[model samples]
Target: MLLKRLIVCLDVRSKRVTKGIKFKGNVDVGDPVEMAERYCNDGADEIVFYDITASAEKRPIDIEMVAAAARRVFVPFTVGGGLRNVVDMRHALLAGADKVSLNSLAVEQPDILHAGALAFGRQCIVLGMDARRVGKSLHFPSGYEVVTHGGRCPTGLDAVEWGRRAEALGAGEICLNAIDTDGMRTGYELEITRKIADAVGIPVIASGGAGTVEHIADAFSTATADAALIASMVHSGEYTCSGIKKELAEKYHLPVRLTSN
Candidate 1:
């Protein structure tokens, strides 16, 4: 198996890193740059900085914050939120993001996916799928549907099929976040994650609902995800990046890099 990564997520809104449950009632966490630096210092494999309200407000992601966070972290970084075109993708890359994630913009204009891949190569373009369960099986077109505008509006698109399409469109990886499980601390929506991972050929990073180290283990072992994106657990002091890595390494015998290079 490929080395599984443990990523710390920073959801930025109005220049602050904030987190919320089920995409609502967000609470301010801290400064994006400061929090990112702390995570980088704590041995985060990679960092994800998302301008959480850019799409909802129909504005571009805060370039200053992106640049600031990029400057503090040496590890690979992914930036998303309000990427509307190739220009935005280029801008984010220029600002220091190793990869750019597309959510609403991809749904609004899927050609952007191909355009981004063509312009920057597939390795630099990531498709961020904000999905929710709609039915019995958690199957795309039947169980999972796309939610946009910071996961507030339903797009009525089948998420699993979209994962397949994202891979075909040259997306390097898929970041699948289960809306229902987001920040609930109940555990991941394994069935939903597995379906998307099985449907797509590229790496999938399972997001949302991870409350424990065991939850992270379950995500990789059962859902077959290449990585897991964690937020509240890390942000709320429930665990540190090093703490989680230590626990995972000891418990699952998985390789976890806990030292800063």
Candidate 2:
């Protein structure tokens, strides 16, 4: 079986890595390139650099800044945020991004995914869906609803249905980020993650609310996610990627890297 990965997320804003609680009250952490190198040296399976403010700020990804972060990491890196079209996608690739993730733009114009997948391989494209817990009353017949534009706008689209559409559009992976759990570090929303994972054939990376190693183990075992994306826990120096991997291997006998972090 392919081993599940532990991904470190660098939420970059204005070229600096930052962390936030519940997706608000952002705090500066360090330089993006510097942090990327640190995580790589610390044995992260992969790194995801999200220009957290790109969409909200209405601008393209800072290519120079992206290049800076990409240069520091030897492992695969994924870039997202502020990417609106094929041109932006190409630029991110040229900046050393192994994969490009789309969120706001994909929700606004889904054709972008198809076009990107055609230009780049399906494996090069990832769909990032930010979902919130809608009250049982708000749950439409479709499934759980997803919000976009940094969770400020409700798309009213079912999260599971959206995952299916993204896969059909040739996205090789889905990053299902639960806004409700973001930065809370409580644990992953297993039910929501499983819903998205079961809806799509491609790999699903669970994001948001990972405070303990047991949460990581529970996500993969119960939710069947291909990987877990962690932010605050790692960013704040609570645990490195290797620390989490060790717990996964010890408790579940899951295949996780034994490298140093």
Candidate 3:
């Protein structure tokens, strides 16, 4: 059995890690580099850093910050936000990101997805889908619409359909982040997660609303996600990656790497 992964997410703005409820009213939480290092030491399987304001500000990701954080962690590091083209994706990889996540830019120029995958293997190309619950509609059969620009713009694209399209376009992984559940800490939006996971062959990482160990375990069991992205739950100092993995391994009987505390 493949061991489930626990990834720590750092939503960075102004070069500082930040967190917000429903993608609004974000406040600085800590330094991205420091947090990445801490999570890596705490046995997090991976670290994801998003330049949360890069798309909204219409600028490139802060490469300096990415390089700094990348230097601190030994695990895989994924970076996203404001990547406009294949060149930007290349720059992020050269800056030490093991994977480059594309969102708004992918929606604008989908060719970048194929181009990036061709330029830097499919495993390095990740499709970060920010989706919101829009209720059932003819256009969105799954009742979830893809939102971009940090959840401020709705693309009218169906989340499940987009996941399938992206996988066919050569994306090796999908990070599904629910805009509605972001920072709410209730639990992951499992219905949409399971839908997308079943639609695509690539690994799916469920993001947003992870409040407890049970929530993470439920995502793996009920949603069939390969990994879960955690932010506020760990950002607030309420949980540790090692602690969560231990719980999953012991209580949930899920395979996870065990590290000595």
Candidate No. with top lDDT: 3
lDDT of 2 at 29: 93
Over 4 Å off, model 3: none
Residues 192-251 of candidate 1 have per-residue lDDT tens digits of 899988888889999999999999999988998989999999899879998898888898
lDDT of each: 0.88, 0.87, 0.92
RMSD for each of the candidates = 1.8, 1.5, 1.1
Please write out the lDDT profile of model 2 over residues 1-261, one tens digit for every residue: 688988999899988888988778999999888888888887788899998888778999888977877667888899998898999999999988999999978888999999999999999999999988875445444346788876889998888888899899888899999998899999999998998888788999999999999898988989999999998998888898777888899988878777843
Q: Per-residue lDDT tens digits of candidate 3, residues 1-261?
A: 678999999989999999999888998999999999999999999999999888779899899988887778889999998788888888889999999998877888888889988999999999999999999899999999999876889998999999999998889999999998989999999999999999989999999889999999999999999999999989999998888998999999999988885
> What's the C-alpha lDDT at position 47 in model 3?
95
What TM-score does structure 1 among the candidates reach? 0.95
The residue pairs found clashing in candidate 1 are none
